[model samples]
Target: MFRHKGKGRRYSHNLKLASILSGVAGLVNITGVLSVNSLTTNVTGHFAFFSEQLFLKNYEMALIYLLYILFFLSGAFISGLIIEWTTKYKPHSSYIIPLSIEIIIILFVGFSPDLIPGISQMIISSALLFAMGLQNALVTRVSQSVVRTTHLTGLFTDLGIELSLLFFHHQKARRKQINKSIFLKLMIILCFFLGGILGAFTYQHFQLKTLLIPVGLLLFALWYDRLLIRYYHIKRKLR
Candidate 1:
């Protein structure tokens, strides 16, 4: 799925990529809130909480919230750096490296509770935010900004604009473009909702162990991408 770019990238590829990643993201976001008492998927809500805490003179929590935002940014920065470093020798590795890093981080996070106590929600929140940040960055790069799995604000905005074009646009080609965008965006949104349902249910029963669910999904993406690429190379050699 990460192998193509621009016009070479297909709607089918984007749909699969968005659905799986968005579903995993939804699981992480809700599960993080349930486990850590903070949202891990996006910084917008944290920024609001930071402002509120600042106004109330709760300086300690305000700083923690500020760290939440920074950690998320740092994760993106780190992933971007890895991409740049890998692209020097293997262009495709840009996506692979960041993705592999994200998977490792998620693994650590999933099992961190084994040694790390549950008393520090802030620490756990930052870890999950970093993982999310890495994922959001990786998806943004691979999709060339066509999709973002972690947040729905911009997706909904684009959906609204596309819906407008689909209904009222005069140009046939423009309408076709709008139609494709709407379908892919809708699939991502619905898949995310489905992920949340799964996360909530798992959390209710298994508690923090629910973190393992997303790890399994992410590993699937990693394995699938790598194996598919390898298969293509072998097929090309035979030709």
Candidate 2:
């Protein structure tokens, strides 16, 4: 999934990509909410809060919400910048730096040292949002905008549109493609829900440490892809 891009990418690649990353996003989403009483995976709600605070003349609180949006945007900017710069020399591994950064952020927050309660919560929420921004950017670039794992708003909207199209578009080939797209969206939604469920259950016992589960999934994806590459190389040599 990380190795393919542009036209070289296939539906199966996106299927695998969406499946894993969406689940990770879901896990992070719930963990952030439970840990900080805030949403960390997306900034839509933050925008609303920012507006409300501004209207109430609570400038300090508004600024805090503004900072949350900026941090998430900054994370996305950094992820895209790294991918663009690294791709020139390391096309296949361009995603590693951003993905690694995300992993580090999650791991750090998971075992973060004690601090003032309010300050700690703020830091944790910002860090996870940043990590998620990194992840969302990486996946978007890797899939050429074909897959987005961080938020469901767009997915549900697209799914609804596409589902409607199925009734009007009658060509078999086109319908087949639409069906594939539908299935991909559904899988992402399903995995994200399941991930949230798993995170909620595990958090009761492990709390922040539950993040390690998604971290493990990411590590496995990296290792498994490398193994596949090696096996392909060996098979080509034998052929």
Candidate 3:
């Protein structure tokens, strides 16, 4: 689900990845908030705080928010860097590698609550946000920028436009397009919501261990894609 460039699977690889990642993202976001008392999946809140702090001339707090935003950007940058660096050495491993890194980051976050329980909230939030940034970039590159997972800003906006078309536009040809768009957005939103619920309930009981839930989802996707690719290659060779 993290590789290839086509209408993969039944609907499309982009939709598949978008659905899975969006769910994982929603899980991380809600659990991160409960753990760190902050949102880590997107920079929207941080941007507002940054601007507010800057306007108030609170350089210290403003700088903190600035760094937080930069950390998210750094995650995206690092994801692209890892992809490019590995591309030449391992052509087929581009997308998988960054996801591996995300898995590692989540693992760290998961363990932090226990192993390093005293870690600062900001530090934890930064790490979670960084993972989200990496995910957003990886999905964009792998999905050819067709979807994003970290936040629903663009998804909701597009969803609204598609909703209007699905309701107002009666052309059969265009209706299919509207239907597809609507399905994709709704799938993401629903998966995200379901993941959020799982995250909330699990975090309530399992605490930091809840992160492993999303990690498991990511690993399953990575492994499934690899297995599918390998199976295809084997079949081709046999033929």
In each prediction, how many residue pairs overlap at the backbone (N, C-alpha, C within less than 3 A)? Answer: 0, 0, 0
Candidate 3 local Cα displacement, residue 180, angstroms: 1.0
Per-model TM-score versus the true fold: 0.94, 0.96, 0.93
Candidate 2, residue 105: how far the Cα is off, in Å: 0.4
What are the runs in model 2 whose C-alpha is more than 4 Å off? Answer: 113-119
* Candidate 1 structure quality by residue, lDDT tens digits, 119-226: 477777888899889989888887889889998999999999878776688788888888889999999899889998999999998776787888888888878878
Q: Candidate 3 residues 119-205, lDDT tens each?
A: 888888888889999999988877778778889888899888878777788999889888987888888888888999999999878
Candidate 2 vs candidate 3: the lDDT winner is: 2
Give the Cα-based TM-score of candidate 3 against the true structure.
0.93
Cα lDDT of model 1 overall? 0.85
By TM-score rank, best first, the candidates go 2, 1, 3
Ten residues in a row with the worst lDDT in model 3?
A: 2-11
lDDT, candidate 2, 1-239, per-residue tens? 89877788889999999999999999999999898888988999999999999999999989989989988998899999999999999998898899889999998888874333335677898999999999999999899888999999999999999999998999999999999999999999999999999999999999898899999988888887788779878999999
TM-score of 1: 0.94
